[model samples]
Target: MYLTVFYALSFCACWRKMYFYKLNMAVRIMTETLIRNHLSHFEVAIAGCGGLGSNAAVALARSGIGKLFMVDFDRVELSNLNRQYFFYDQIGQYKAHALADNIHRIDKSIGLRTSIVKLDETSVTQLFATVDLVIEAFDQAAEKQMLLETMLVNFPEKPLIMGNGMAGFGKFELIKQQQWDKQVYICGDFTNEISEDNPPLAPRVGIVANMQANLALDLILKMRK
Candidate 1:
């Protein structure tokens, strides 16, 4: 009887030890997988800190992007609060500066940098030269064309992702991604535009911006491989 009791206690101890050992191994594996899958080494430049830019910046910062370069000349307006990420108190503040603060609030570890300056044809290349990826989030068609042209001419080697045509309701399926050319990817419906009658809303704009952020993250991960 004494021998049987001793053996039973020994088996219980061994089982508990093995169970903990496996749990620790699983935890270590999960940690390593997360580290390996992180895109924390890449820097992205987001031009135009309006709806698309600000939303995408928040997504990327949360996804573990190491650095961000946000550029925008516009100030946050009360109307912009409908789609943009700024708070009510941030009205009249530069979008770039406000966006950087907002992003830091989401992920304080992110290296948030802001340029409260206009990005024209001449300045586009210099502003985005150091970033690993570029996201064009301007609302105006003319500005989008200008930035697209500038990127193709100066930084043709880098990837330029832009969003367009995300302005209405019930057209969720239309909001998709397309590769315009080598090093150029466009996200949105490719048809709709915001106007006096059709104002920019949050849900659709957020969907498109999130898509751009996801695509950018995927591209960064692919580059790593």
Candidate 2:
């Protein structure tokens, strides 16, 4: 009788464990299916990996962008910690590689490509031609304007999303999206420039970067619909 009782209890325990394991596996598969349905088809290019670029890349990865191409010639510096994503130990490392490494830590399944080369008129168009969206995240106005124009000329059908006037603290209302022409969308305060009075800090810069990422995702979803 005691042997029969022991066998019955062991069977119940094993059955319960099997039931929960299957339940957990089912949940995981459902979650991945939902994410893939929404974000498994888009590719993105980030022009620079500074304050705006690094944060925007992270946002996109978390949002489940299928692939990313990031290019930045500069190395991580101590000053970049004020807003950028690199750690102190990552100082002197190339920004593109470091950003990609950090992003992988967040989602290893994401497709990542990094280029540690400076961009110019000749290289910009070719590098970003295949991407569904081009995010201009350079700190300087000249670079932003140059890349924006080059992209529009080369890939007139593609969308170019950028940020401008995001260098201040507070005044969140001013930081919004402005549609330029047909395929360009600029997100920022659009008035504040990086100066002594308006230094680029983390909060304001992240707000704008996230806005750009959200806008990019929104555009991609709209196209699918």
lDDT of 1 by residue, 1-225 (tens): 999999999999999999988996765433534643566778999998999999999988877888999999899999999999999999999999999888888888888888888789878877788889999999899999999999999998889899989987777878889999899999999988898877889999999899999889878866752
Each prediction's TM-score versus the true structure: 0.83, 0.83
Q: Which segments of candidate 2 are over 4 A away from where they belong?
A: 1-35
Clashing pairs in 1: none
The model with the greatest lDDT is: 2
The 0-to-1 C-alpha lDDT of every candidate, in the order given, reads 0.88, 0.89
lDDT of 2: 0.89
Cα lDDT tens digits, model 2, 1-225, are: 999999999999999999988996665334556655667688899999999999999999988888999999999999999999889999999999999999999999899998887898889976887888889999888999899889878888899999998887989888789999699999998899998877999999999999999888777765662
